[model samples]
Target: MFWEPLRARFTREALTRSFVALRIRDYRRWSIAQLLSGAGAAASQIAIAWLVIELGGDGIALGAVTACMMLPTLLLGPFIGILVDRHTRRAVLLVTAVAQMLIAGVLAALTFGGALELWMLMALSLAHGVAFAADNPARQLLVMDIVGRERMTSAVSMNEVIINGARVIGPAIAGVLLVVSDAGWCFVVNVLMFVPSIFVLLSLRPVAPAGRTEPADSTAAAARPIGAWRFAMHTPAIRATLLLAVCASACYNIAVVVPLIVADVFHADGGTYGALAVAFGLGALPGAFFSATGPTMPRSAEVRAMAVAMAAAVLLSAGAPTLPLLFVGLAAVGMVVMWFIARANAFVMLSTPTAIRGRVMGIWAMALPGSTVVTGLLIGGLADLTDPRIAYGAVGLVTALVVTLSWRGLRSAR
Candidate 1:
């Protein structure tokens, strides 16, 4: 599901077809762990953003902290991608899980002791992002390890379901913790979330990627150092999808604006922040479920089309003057953006080989959380200068223009 991502066309039957990925036993077990970890991550993100606001920090501080969490992937993702391809994905994942737990512990400790500062938070976040870069590709390519290629389309959609579902639960939990306890408790939850996944990974055995009859080691031997980069750059469908992702990354970065909008525009509190985030996750769930029926790899044209639709969703979200309307708008954004991302990710995963997927998907990773390194600050700064509505409107227009102007390069996927 790495190469081509989807058609905007959808129907009622898609709801039933989306369950196709659940038939595999290993994938079900793997998804359970993914759901928990994703929830904890989502919860922690809101917790951190609220903590920044509480700590005498401004929008720039929010942007810097967010940027720090993503900066490592922009800087080291490609190299780390190659590294995971050369080794056992399980080991890389295990190490990353442990590293994140330790970092979360320290963060929790600092906050609980009343000694947590903005700089300390940023430092820990940068460390977390470093672990995140290593964690992402290894974990993703491991889907190939658990489920074969034929199911990759539904599996990717199911993965979105897990992520967005976590988004729904995580923020709700964070909202409660922020009201009753402290942000430190959110970090404590993060420390605990990885425990089941570590056990699951330790219990699992490895499988070879699709199209590979050889043992896993032989596959690793053929995954050359620069192969993923060269393959993605040269491949037209993959190239177009990823390029669109650069703009998609910037446009979809609404985290910075959500808090600002809730506070400044809506005059809301922590509960409202979590409610809006939940709305986003909830809205995406149906689309994520519906997307499970498509071809494993999407045509490049459809990917471009989805980008335009997502831009419209963002602009509408920006213009929502009332909170209820904002919920409707953000939910719409989440629904459309989920499809956009699902298409982009499936393109990269399905079009490429199992052997080199780790490295290639690393480059894909560079486009999102990696792109956030710049977009995070830009969004934060834009909101600081104007307002959330301006920040959202500007990025929305830019995404529409970028996707609309460059329509010719990708040859129709053969």
Candidate 2:
């Protein structure tokens, strides 16, 4: 009787459109695997940062380690994207998964054997970065291949939800593990987590690239290194979207800046910092779901509005007088920022042709980590010279200025 009611409630006509993408079998499998992989990745991030601290490394050391991790995305993203387009995406994903598994295992062994050093960690981070440079584009293109364009927006939004959920859960798990055991165990958990994803990828049927029926000769001709760049440069909508992404990336430096505020300004510990991160992730859940379920709006207006909202939230966070207020501000920031990201991603995907999607996404991918390197350096230097709060305020100001200046172009493009 209970099952009957639940089944009726979930009938085709009764279910929300936001979940329509999950009705596809391959996408469901991919999503589950992505969840596992995302959670492990998130947990590994916490473990890596905590490990650096435990090793008596200071802020500079942490920054260096992070830079090592992101540098490959900046350096190799274009080439990786081209490679993804030229080859089978599933093979790329499998290879990257195996490579990451091996890297994580090595890190775990080194840590357990007491042979892990800062330089070794940096080297491992660089290797992981190289793997991710390929993995990111392949994974994105694979989503489009499985679900097709109609459900692409929903799938992307759900993917963000999974990623944010993992961000919340992973750190908490890492924190607990660190309390009971150590960072090495966290790495071991990460290595084990990759197992399910690898198996899932192996089981999935090959999905041919959508709308891509070009002859081998044509594909080869278009696979030149500068092809993707030329396309992005000449395309107004793509160019505008990427520029907006660049601004969003700079604004996202708040991720690094907020931890500093929690520790230095709020006089809090690691647990408190984790709580704040969880709050942000929790806020992102509803934001992502709303974007997935809600009616489609004008992309330019949505982008501009969300950017303004994020700016206001950042300012509020920077000026927050109490921890409670800060939490509220951070939650608002997370919500709007995620909404912005979902819209921006959909806009880019919808604007680009399927033939060059991987290369375009690669460029988009580059904007994210590339901007991280830029904003990281900028925020770190400014914070050292003045206050973290001031650094955040400056970022917000720049974000607002960039969004406002681009308003007309984005609107006309829409």
Best by lDDT: 1
Q: What is candidate 2's CA lDDT for residue 180?
A: 69
Q: Residues 1-414, candidate 1, lDDT per residue (tens digit)?
A: 434332333545554456666888878988998888888888888888888887887768888998999998988866775567556888888899999989989988999999999999999999999999888878877886777666666677788889889999888888888878888998899888888899889888954332332466556544553788888888877777787787777765666778888877878887788888889889888767655666545767657767888889889989987899999998988887887888777777778887677567778888876988888788888889988789888878888876766565455455
Q: State TM-scores per candidate.
A: 0.88, 0.86
Candidate 1: C-alpha lDDT: 0.79
Model 2, span 211-280: residue lDDT tens: 4435766667446547878988887667776876776776654445665676678877555665676677
lDDT of each: 0.79, 0.74
| Model 1 spans > 4 angstroms off | 1-18, 206-237, 349-358, 410-414
**Best-matching candidate per TM-score:** 1
